[model samples]
Target: MSKPRRWLVAIAGAVVAAGLAVPPSAVAQADEPIQDPLPDPVPSSLGLTVAEFAQFPKTELTPPPPDPPPDLRLIRHARINHLGEVPDGSGRLYVPDLNGRVYLVENGTQHIYVDFKAQFPDFFSGRGLGSGSGFVTFHPDFKRNGKFYTVHTENGAGLTKPTTWPSHSANPFLHSIITEWTATDPSADTFSGTRRQVMRIAEARQVHAIQQIDFNPYARKGSRDYGVLYVASGDGGQGATTTEPQQLGNPYGKILRINPTGTNGTGGQFGIPSDNPFVGTPGALGEIYAIGMRDPHRFSWDRATGRMYLGHIGEHRIEAVYDVRAGDNYGWSEREGEFLYKRNDPQCSVYPLPPDDAQYGYDYPVAAFDHNPPPGHPLCSDSGHAISGGFVYRGSIAELRGKYVFTDLVDGRIFYTEASEMRRGRPAAQIHQFQVYANGQRTDFRQLVGDARVDLRFGQDARGELYLVAKANGKVYKVTGIKRFASCAVGHTRVTGSGGADSWSPVTPDKWQFRGDSVILAEAGEARPGPRRPFEYAVLDKGPAFTNARVDTKVRLDTPVEVTNRDVIVVFGYASDTEFYYAHVSTDNTIYPHNGIFAVNNADRLRIDDQWNEVMSRGAPPAITDTAWHDVSVTHCADTGEISVRVDGELLMTAVDHTFGAGRTGFGSFDNIGRARDFRATGTAA
Candidate 1:
């Protein structure tokens, strides 16, 4: 397909009617409008103000001030739910919207990666969560092999192999297909990936189609989870009489673990992992990893503890999180979060009814809360509406470092729990609410999307920092302000004054001419890459090799911003120009990845360890190109390997790294014109 036609189909609303095998004529009619089999009702309640939901709970201990300040900033606006990351270092990101489009995000911008809506034009995309395109998972060796997979309901009869079990009926249920893709170039923005259908799953219902697709992160190259792909099989049908969750005859209401590469012992396109709990069982399916779960939609594994955390939606009453164990049964038709469940009762799935431990033997929830109750339990309905699984905090946030951070789908409320305390038998006290804010002020996520359904889903970057996605408004947010170390206290040593001829020395060749009060840096002749940097710069000469110190610079760009050159640059923790970190303030109308803290390896600039995903546009923080002298400061904590950037005396961003220690301070712009006026370097004599 031509690029123009690809973009046109991507922009136009398109959907595939799902079933067995699509007619050849149907592929030609791919641009038709999408109609859902069933429409989902709008969520109840308008919304709550930020103050109403935020809890300023008193605690005896806290992380030292300012790290991970409770604030979130919308980074990308898209209708994407599940997130996929390439193991490559550039932090290349991908997400699939239910509209059947997959987007690749680069430097806070979205590009069309693939359009499944056009490929499978005869697939079902109902108004429910399982509709449209399902999940995407990359191969463990995706970087080298360029292989990946995706799941969506389809009518590709030619693609499906005969099912050993009774797969689908001719009525409301459909066939959900999982397809593999091989990328020509694994790092490209365009979809040069070729598709190959892997498996066709028969669903008894439309809503609980194939939901999850993931390769185990903790599994070593030789371990059981290493090459295995874990898929969540919803009870292929809906309604109370649907007891497929109890009957392991089919892979519904259960977690299916498989080897995508048929090279294993079994004989199929994908082999069943030998270690699967049901592999040797007489009556159970070999692919069944665990049984008895309804809508076990969003679950994650903690790299720190290797514990599987799952957040499942309740029938109408209790929302629960489970510490998933292999072969464990989460009683859906039998019970909801340990409560006695009557499948046919009108209030069967409703909440607040206490559990009857004497009844069924089931794996209960680690934490659960009643959302809406009928008549009896006053304690019910206190928590948020639905569950959206999140990750354990292992990033720079000191206070929330070891806790589990997750949310509710309807109200967008946030909560955390001590990883150790949240066990199988723990009660409601194990869960705790955490106040969320935007730039240190309280803000509600529902309000972020104008009080609509925050169908809240969570994602983490290659750095393990978390991100939130709101499907209603197609928005993405970064949970920022996690401070690692406090500001470096500059002691008695002070080299203060305008960085002019006497105070500055040309680190590279001399593109900087020191005026009396300010240093003017401009391109010298045909600009060539310096030994340390690509542009000319100046360094502070009189220093004691300062270890922990603070340096500030007042920079002014030339009139009529030069769009071709690098932006303002300040280097610190500098052993040499080739071996230091710098604050590459965001540039306007530039193609380079600027406006973030960066490190230097072999004199080339690299991104720092950050709670990242910042959009470096004119709308971003610190408009440095306005020819105004903005105050920029870089603080280094040698003890902690952290660097914090402050623009105009306010905190801009904080990052952690220990590649280089205390050297000297320097300033200049890359192949551009800028003026450095108030250059002050203060610290204890190194």
Candidate 2:
């Protein structure tokens, strides 16, 4: 027989064993008639007397209030498509966009100080210089040297020669390039001066080319003195791939720290810093501080902690933020987020490095989100294809103080984190406390819109104010604070039976049914995730009533599960109803069930006696005994359509049934009469 049918049989047997009447055997076994006498009925309630019910509380304790909301403002908006900030508090902004024109927004009045394409007319060639993929940064002593640098994609030099190759061989186009320039006057805004060629790498693909560049903020100016320039290169322009050897050594998929002067030390463009992590590492490039990055769109440093935060685009499932330390290797091409992606078990060779490998530093993201919106909460999802890292809020906004603010380019939702709550460890710890701010209320940070993209790169001024770069409209928005709203209270009450003070309603009474009573199911408990032992919920089910109608009690779980899928069931129904609902063969619950079942459903709504049809079931034999108290409701949803049943919130038999949805709705037929059925079908027996 199928599991569902077997479950029905078992439940029938239990009812008979509990001294309940059973119809004549519908199906006979081939062997001898093995029927046993009925057992004592188990009451739904564990036998609490009248005095005990009087002392029980009726309502749940309220949750603590959340932190107040802050006042929000929109300071200034810029028309730049993409933007980056200078590390030194110099109130200047660098913007580049689809126009292929790179402009410098300098000083206080949002002035376009330098135009790169205008200064280098021949180099630009009118093709608009492709996309302004990189930001401009000055040498440490810009006041004295007047030297600054930028990385961008320029029209490729055409080649006429043709060569033969296998048909399956790959042939890619080149569109990305990096270059450095110096201003003629140290104090002037124009870039009318000498153009020095630092180093240019070939872009075999157009997608992930020339992301962003920055000069080490800590680097100083002097011959052999200034720190190395840090260039964040995407892994080719394409998505995740390991076929290119250039990604490892050719400065393509890395954060390359190079000295503008050449390696020979004299007359070179840039000098490499002496403290470069890979200066002497075997078979590794000397300029590499860390390696193994894919589509590293943006990165930032916390001035207070010197911690580097990287926003990496994942191939699937997750968009992660990493806390990078020197020599750390962020797993890419082999792993995404904290899960392993690639492996060769025979010899156990992995591309980015194995999870257990200690030589390479595997940094963990400080915060992460799924690409798609989670079930129940749809507002947190962003439409952007990639995740962008923003600056740590060192700004003057009192509400944003000491928080890390970021946004998803696709959905344009703003999220922030409390600095103190972030985990601090070796590579970097994921931020579990990140929250989304909508209007003035804090809502679940999930997919808000199915289709909205915002290209959010960070923008900061000398004063530390933060700004966002919007890609769709090519604009920048300065983040201001928003005010918080008063907290609202939520409560629930259940009524059973009638005609005393008009306060009580009628409910189906089972074997040990009581006349009039109510119960409190939940009180104080830990809100945090992880194994919470001895968590308690209160039960109250005794009082005077005014009317007569069957009332049902229900409990719902709001928190998502992480570790063990177990919950403590606290119930206070009439003793008989509780016993029937807690029948060994009739309970089932699970997590992530196949049918998209959730806790919130129509049945969860409290009902008056007349409305009890929404959950009542007729025709099935009653499972409750008149004078017994029992505990029920231990259930779980399996990864599949199966439901594991337990009594009194404890494990029972796991029965597989395709008819039931993942969600449990109604709660009327207190006894086993409607046990193991899907939504209770209604009809009173004649």
Candidate 3:
């Protein structure tokens, strides 16, 4: 057989070249060790700072309507699946609930735009998590065409009808149907028009069916892709038992591209684009654009590069995001992520790839994360299984620009990677997890939604701003603003009290004494009247006020090690003795205020670091445990509001806060004694 030209060097590319052909079955032998069991849970690097803002409240509809069958009931408070804006330039957005209602949102107010259950009595959204009113999208010319589309599932309603796509399962259970809706008034708030069936596919089960359908938002009116709709179809959880995904005749496990207005497809429902990848191939469906997928759940295109990205839910160990290209086959049953999926040997679901494995020509993901659940949890539990695809941020937020932000569907942990690094042939890009915020304080989706399983999804607007849609409380949060820090590579100078070019002044001169080059905290000062904060410290009175400050010094704890809370604090963003942020590197981390990064703003210090766990009694280890001097550095970026504290050249703790900016640096303690020397500071002089 001829080698597939679309194949490129990828995972295990160093093992062998693409020209060395070998039998596909030779890729995984029974005796091979399970070299790649699971991926590391923690990402090694850090990326852009991300924050989510609460945008809209819960929708009007509470699904199941207080009385429904057990199979129809939902565990979440609402089933808000996806959100998107209408292409008519109305600045209006639409959100679809799995309970069959699509609400039109204007600013913060929402009204029922259409109800699938009320319009089509046979519309089914029960018995499976994915079986519901799935998705909706508008034509690019929606301002003049008055046309749009939707995909939904039914409980075997179309079994008698001829399925447009072929399936190997004889006991097909659910039917995924697509329809075209024409609005009477293109500019109306509510949909009022005629409807027509586009196509239907019979599936073995309810899950892993059609979940997303959208038109290329970047396609111009005269472009060939202008009216084309891309349908993401899954294998209905049957890819492992059958080899149908490798066959060209099946639409399942494929992304089908078709012209909704043309009439050349099966059943005369839609037109298969002539330029489709498999149009003229023998026994292949003309509508297939790309094949070999288990669950092509969600996909989006980057506006800057016009490259498509799809999040494919894996079978057992991997969850991945693919850099999709036409005519490229993504290996599903045969491989997961970059490893071989052993079918006959269920004991080892994945194994290392053989030497000549690339000859089969399977495309791999550009970025992926593996399953890591609690001990004894089910292999593919919902704890962390699915990947919710997201777009490359061309949004108004400057910090998030050019980053492809996505999340885990179950855990709701947000992640992003540089769009430039998501190349197909080379190694996968490094993915970074970002913290979530609500109202102005640092928070997480679990805390905001009050559910361990966040059931998270994403939405993007015409202006490129993004939103976080949580099914837990039916609330939508917008990306109001982002904070990024500037580098401390400029205006660096040494600081000393010898009254030279750069010097310092003690806040409480009586409580501090200079011994050669070391500044000693001789005694603790009286408690402040307003808030409980650092009582004694010396300020950078000679240097210019700095933003994005970096301070490096050597500190020795003068207090005995037996003092549980003995600490040497580094302070920056200091507008006054009362307003400043500090990294309290203490001897004990069990206490809430000890060994944490904090911000004091005319009030008591608030713990801002992510490492502080009040219930778990855990935090960064003591930076200064004895009388020995320890090398410490504190870097704060005012642009991103990121503060990082390092001990002995290793990052110990970090926090994000914009409460104060462009302030002087200082060193002392919260209520203990310490001494500092070799003090140096660098930052943007404000």
Error of 1 at 112 (Å): 1.3
Give TM-scores for every candidate, taking all chains together and pairing residue i with residue i. Answer: 0.57, 0.54, 0.72
What does candidate 2's lDDT look like per residue over 1-686, in tens digits?
11111111122111011111111211222322111111111111111010000010111101111233121111112214345554444545656543334556654234445554554432222222123334566676666566777765444342111211111116534334445666677565445777755655555554565566665453334543254567776666443445232233345456766777455322244566777765644445566666666677777667666666777776544566776655555556444554443422221111222323332233445566544323332222332345667767676666666766565654554555555555533222323222333343333222222224444455655456666565434444554544321111111223232222242222322211222332221222332222221123222222421111122233222222321222323222112221211111212222221111122112221211100112212111122222223344323221222222223343222222222222211232211121111111111111
The lDDT per prediction is 0.62, 0.39, 0.75
Q: Which parts of model 2 are misplaced by more than 4 Å?
A: 1-90, 104-111, 116-133, 158-172, 186-190, 218-227, 237-248, 261-267, 343-361, 373-384, 417-451, 485-686
Query: What is the C-alpha lDDT profile of model 3 across 452-494, one tens digit per residue?
Result: 8888988998888888888887787777766332233545554
Better of 1 and 2 by lDDT: 1
Over 4 Å off, model 1:
1-78, 155-168, 263-267, 349-360, 373-384, 482-686
Candidate 1 per-residue C-alpha lDDT over 1-686 given as tens digits, one digit per residue, 9 for 90 to 100: 11111111111111111122211211222322221111112111111112111111111101112444331221223346766566656577777776577777766666667777668766555334566577777787887888888887654442254543446465434677778888998877777858876667766665666778888666778876787888887776552466667665567778888888774423366788888866755556778777677777788888888888888776656677888867667777666665555666643443322323322345667766556332353322323367777887787756667777778876777776677766664343255544455554334687676755677777777677777777656766777753224345667677754646667677554566776667677653234565335366777776566777788778876735656343777777777657777777755422334666777767567666342433322122433757777888888777666577777765555566777767788787665677777777777666
Please give the distance, in angstroms, between residue 99's alpha carbon in candidate 1 and its true position after superposition: 0.7
Q: Count the backbone clashes (under 3 Å) in each candidate.
A: 23, 83, 4
Output the worst ten-in-a-row residue range by lDDT, candidate 3: 8-17
Candidate 2 at residue 639, lDDT? 26
Question: Which is the leading candidate under TM-score?
Answer: 3
